[model samples]
Target: MAETRVGGARIRYDDVGQGGPTLLFIPGWCTSRAVFRKLAPWCSTLHRTLVVDLPGHGESSLPGMDFENATVVDILRSVIDASGARQVVPVALSHGGWWALELRRQLGSRIPALVLLDWLVLEPPPAFLQAVRALQTPQWRQAREGLFSLWLQGVSSPDVIRFVQEDMGSFGEDMWKRAGREVSRAYAQYGSPLRALSALSSPVPTLHLYAQPEDSAWLDAQRSFASSHPWYQVQKLPARSHFPLLELPEEMAARIGRFIDARVDVGNPLDRLAPSPS
Candidate 1:
């Protein structure tokens, strides 16, 4: 376990293995590095891997700070710098994709590739929007519980269920409220993950792996986006849970390995020194 201080917050992470173009795993909102326990260790065998417990989540402490995007990115930046990684591939899950995209936007060529796990990258549906709104009200706990029920619709594994319940249930009211507001703010700012990636000045090779969408239209939208953007690729895995990384870490790791092997040239020196966005 290694630690980096951003502002007064102590961001904790697990840094394992040794190599260039490290894989940095970022968990979803309200979750921690434990979410990537199975996945990150597997990837670490092939390349350097850093699994972070974002401030206010997992083992990290978020003293006197809100769980906003800029602060999270700053902490992530500190982790990368402290670990001395010249090139990186951010494997972000769910809402974590927001910070990963922002990091790529800030760091540019230093991030050669990106992998998103089961994120709602297109325009959120009315139901999702309503849910986010509900999360801001006094009944936020109920709203969050409802969202959890929805996410676990078809999940049956005891391990996965316990993980989701415990981790997602661990946050306090302030953190949960901040999570809701931040998500709403991210959608307001970037519209969607697709739009966020599109706004980038330089293309970063990206692979989005999803389990299932709320509807066929969502899947089609991602397919359409990938078809138009050469830098983006989308794949649907045989998964039914929202937390696919927890449910299918081995499979997820294998798919990510193949994507990196095929898309990113880890040996290319120029990719490591790619200039920051102007």
Candidate 2:
């Protein structure tokens, strides 16, 4: 475990093993780098792994600012810069994939490839954006505990359920409110990650591993995007839960390992970099 001071926030991460192209892991909302604890070792054999805890979640500190989408990108960039990694393969889960994509959008070719694990991507309609904002407010937070836990029970394993419950009990109020507020702000401001990625002129080589029984909207979006851009590919994991990484770590790691091996081994090394804007 290590901490880096990125501006006012203290970003915490676990740097396991060493080598290249560096594999950076960004966990989803609510959970921290701890979520990747079981998965990192399998990947470390081939690539250096950095499992990070974004601000306001896990062991990192957010200081005075809110954790919006842009801020999330900034934190990831800071971590990459601090590590002196010239080229990277970002492996992200859930909402973390949005931040990873945003970073790739900004840095361009510095990013080599992306592994999206059951990530949610949608431009979100106007009504949905409004609804998201509404859910972010204090009123929703006041009424969310039971409903949220129940929702967790339906989608996650007993371990994940326990983790969520414990996380909520320990860092529930601030983390939950801040995450919801920031994600809503991101959708309202920058639109959905799917929209942003779809708009890219050159597609980043992406491998999306989604859990079975996925969100239809996400499936539709990724399918549409991949159909047009051959560089993108999507596969469904055998598992049905939201946190498949936790439920099936070995299978998840094997799938990720295959993607990393296949995608990174393409002929021209330069092809891995993002193309310059036209």
Candidate 3:
């Protein structure tokens, strides 16, 4: 466990392994680095890995800072610099994908690749949007619990279930309220994860790993995007949970390892794969 101060807030992270092009793991909203406990250590064997607990989550302290995009990116940049990593591959989970994209936008070539886990990369449906909006109202707790139920539809793993229940349960009302607004703000800014990826100034070798087959439409959208964009790819994992990291960490690590070896270990691989836009 290591710590760095960003904007007077203490950010905590785990720095492990040793090599260039470090794997930086960013957990989703209201979740801690513990979400990456198994994944990060496994990746560390292949390359240096840094798993962070964003301010106000896990062991980190927020003090007076707001948990917005810029603040999160600043903390991430500080972590990368403190670890002396010249290059990074952000393995972001859920909403953390937003921050990962922003970090890449800020750092450019320093970000070699991106891996998104179980994020809604397409435009959300009206019901989904409505559910998120409800999180800002007085009934936020009920709304959050309902969303959690939906996300855990097919999850049967005891560990995964307990983690989600406990982690989400641990947040206070203020944090939940803030998370609701931040999520809505992120969508407003980038439209969707697909739009954000497309808007990148440079094509980044990216992968979206998901486990929800119930939403066939969302899965199909991801496949469609990946089919057209050589720099992007999507894979649906067999895990029956939204939190595949907790359910199938070894498999996730193996998949990520293969991606790094094939697309990122080489020099400018996306250049050879991604055609120049006319």
Candidate 4:
């Protein structure tokens, strides 16, 4: 676990392996780099892999930095510039995917390649965000509080769950209570960075791993965006509820390995080996 001070936040990251085509792994919000423990090693066989913990999550610190200006994109660009890696691929899940698009918008043709998962957009319009903001009912609170379980089911290693229960118990009420506020702030107040997703004009090798039928909206939207842009590949994990990385880290890592390897053409060891998604 290496920690660096990036723009007033103590960003924690895990860097492993040694090879060309460095990979930056970004997990979903509130989750730690530990989620990629299994996947990083697989990527290491062919590429230098680094998984980072976003601020306010994992071992990273939360700063009062403007969330809109110093967004996930800023943090990632800073990491790339600071890492001294000439070019790197971004493999992001959930919120990480949203930020990756922003990076594409910021970096233009420099991005090595992109791999996005399930929920990657700036979701919820102003009115919808406002509506969720007004949900103070016990039922809504309970549902929000339980979002962790639903999310974790995708990537819950035994150790990962233990770590959350022991170290992040305080996050339960605290996180759910503020989820709506943060969403609204990022969506409405932040000026909607999601438009950047459909606006990416780069020709980088891109792949989207979607949990089929679950996030059909996001899947369809990104696919549509990709269709009109550079060549992109889409892998549908049928019936998979969001969180392919957590729900099946081995499969996720293997697939990512194959994708990166296929892009680089060195014959990725994980290629054609992943059990076909059900």
What TM-scores do the predictions have? 0.93, 0.83, 0.93, 0.71
Give the per-residue lDDT of model 3 (tens digit) for 148-206: 89877867898788888998679877888888888899998889989989999999999
After superposition, which runs of candidate 4 have C-alpha atoms over 4 Å from their true positions?
65-71, 120-140, 146-195, 212-230, 238-241, 262-278
Candidate 2 per-residue lDDT, tens place, 23-142, comes to 889987777777777778888766667889888777888856554667778888888877766677899987777788887888877776888887556556564455446556766554
For TM-score, the strongest prediction is: 1
lDDT of 1 by residue, 1-278 (tens): 88888888888888887555789999878888888888887787677788999888888998564557788888899999887788889999899999899888899888889999889898888899889888888999999999989878888977678887988888868888888899999999889889889989988899998887657777888889888898999888777787777778888889898888888887766433433222
Question: What is the lDDT for 99 in model 3?
Answer: 90
Q: Evaluate model 4: give its lDDT.
A: 0.61
**Relative to the unseen true structure, what is the C-alpha lDDT of residue 191 in candidate 3, on a scale of 0 to 100?**
90
lDDT (0-100) at residue 260 of candidate 4? Answer: 73
The TM-score obtained by model 3 is: 0.93
Per-residue lDDT of candidate 4, residues 1-278 (tens digit)? 55567668878777666665678898765566776766677777766777888777778777553354246667777777666555567888655665676676677655657887765353455544544465334555555546545545655355546544544344444444454445455565434433544445645677777663465675676667657865576777743345455456667667777887677542343422322111
Reference-based lDDT, residue 207, model 3: 88
Ranked candidates (lDDT, high to low): 1, 3, 2, 4
Give the top-scoring candidate (lDDT). 1
lDDT of 3 at 169: 74
Query: Which candidate model has the greater TM-score, 1 or 3?
Result: 1
